[model samples]
Target: MAHDLTTPRDGIPPVLSTPASFREAAAALASGQGPLAIDTERASGFRYDDRAFLVQIRRRDVGTFLLDPEGHRTEFTAALAPVLNGQDWILHAAPSDLPSLAWLGLYPGSLFDTELGGRLAGLDHVNLAAMTELLLDVRLAKGHGAEDWSQRPLPANWLAYAALDVELLLELGDTMAEILDNQGKLDWASEEFEYIRNTHSTITGPAEATWRSVRGVASLTRPEQLAVARELWMIRESIAVEEDRAVSRILPNKVLIEIARLLPRTARELVRVKGFRRSEVRFWGEIIQRALESDPRTWPTRDRPPRGLPSRQTWAAEHPDSWERFSNARTLLDDLSADLAIPVENILKPAVLRTVAWGATVGREIRSPLDLPDVLRDYQARNWQVELTAPILTETLFR
Candidate 1:
């Protein structure tokens, strides 16, 4: 049985056999539609981060093309820049995909997330397959559940899986839009979707660290934790970059924090940390030791984050309304998320909510939709984020 691709793929289905084909495809992408449907597949089970072992972009009215980031060296600057320059993109779960794309030098713009739309519109089940089935009556098969996308000459099964991955996205987004419009929730979802498209990559460089971002580290002495954190952070950064994977692939934050607090001074000390398996220590033990031994006092304090967590009592005292608002927001988020068949956390992350709460109270602003990231002034001036803080703050705090 001959399989058909999602679309004609610019009349030449990007083979990605060489640089020339890639360049041609990139040019085609720029000249194509204003919005595109995109998905990526990587060897995540075997590797650390989700990278474009295979990048699939389907431009409405144009076609879907698969880019081989590994084999093709065609600069994505020209091809991807135009699409992202001032265009809207439709994606189901774009938040997860876009970050990794940024690492590979592609950042999308003006997103319309159907999953988000479904939630705002009070619909049920927003996963691509479910949404497509409900909206378009297309029962996309899910056979390629664990296919390895890194392998060249992608298998027929995988290609079908990939094609079906985006075949109904454009239609599904349109259906979700109609539903949103009917419910008077279009503006709300549109605001949130715009926020999603404009999201920037959180991972900046090796020098800037995230291991210390873990909770409970504040219990440790600031200097000691900072020194160990910097060391572990740098180690993780190097490992991630070298392995071309996410830092968590090297080790999760819990393990990293545990190691930092323990300040494992030697290979033998490494064993005390729960997740620090012997092989991991064998690979990174020396480096860890050097970091633990470094004088925390001498380490630069300019960017050393304060190591601590706020007591529940202190948090409650600081923002009496927050707990209620957070609780209300969580229930709303959970209900809507379950209705849309997406994870609740996907719609409103608690970390983002924390930042929103603090920013509003400290900055003295009111924002809408009480449970998103803070509408920072500087962030607002620069990026495309919606100034949603004002209304959210008012409803959640003042009201």
Candidate 2:
């Protein structure tokens, strides 16, 4: 039975927020040996800026360091970025964390993503907690994952949770590497890690016209509903940005959708809608009415934005030949996945496969008969992936 992993073996380290402290932290880290195990805490749903407020790093000789990136921005960039870059890093779900770190000018020299390693090793569950239990026999307690990391003077328990993130990460990375080596997949994992490191963008801020991402917004097909949802989203965005609070705290997507659907005419009516609080109705009642009464021209002109790659389910009826080609290629991929013990998505990204299948069926022009490799590269398939799948795709798709 796996026991709960609660406290850090070294106890919770104090947060380093000052330039002087950051310099010391960098010095300490530089002296430590081996790859660094790192994690970052972000207020994704709680703040408009998805920046890493807190960064956790650990090494063998040096103890863990919890850094406040927001406190000493210039100092942090100058001090830690030098020590951090040009070193092998072990991260979990690096795609999520890399962008945030990169926003602060921190980049990894090379990476070993434990989560991706577990996936390559064909583990049933690859999350940090799951891998810990399976590989290290320790159960990590769950809490504070959704906390507002922007809050200053983080509580001790939250600090402990943060510390625990990196406490075992180095050990986990080592074990995961061993597993990959034994399975003859360390090279494959390396290629995937490099692809992720190179491809992830440093832009970490929320996107413009963000309302389209709200839950259930796509389900509302009516023009009026889309308009109301957009209005609510705009108001929520403004409030969240100005106040530095999560948009959901201002108005949850479900409540926004509810008000959009009902188009309530009065504060009394808006308050009655389930999930919408009366206090919110009193404050935004006028804004809601204006949205409903606004000129139809001002409303979102499109009911739903245009999307690429028609749904795969519709292909059988609308594009039978493409569907047949996709199905045949997908079957070959599945067999390859089983033989290689790699997930199909890991073998080739699903979107790339779909695009390739469709393009091949339509006789999309190519420079040469051996143009499959070039096409795969265009779709962001790495060299290792191309080596494994291009021949099979050429035989099944191009021919």
TM-score: which candidate is best? 2
Question: What root-mean-square deviation over C-alphas does model 1 reach?
Answer: 6.4
Query: In candidate 2, which residue ranges exceed 4 Å CA deviation?
Result: 1-4, 137-142, 204-209, 212-227, 295-297, 303-307, 311-313, 363-369
lDDT of 2: 0.85
Per-prediction TM-score, please?
0.68, 0.88
Provide the overall lDDT of each model, using Cα atoms, as 2-decimal numbers: 0.63, 0.85
For candidate 2, lDDT tens digit of each residue in 1-399?
A: 899978887788999899999999999999999999999999978787678999999998998999997967878989998999878999999998988888787888899999999999999899898999999999886588889898888998999999998888998999999999999999999999998887764453434658887888878777877888888888888888799887777888788888888888877788889888876666678777777788987777544466566776776888887787678888999998998788999989988888777767764654343878898988888888999888777777655
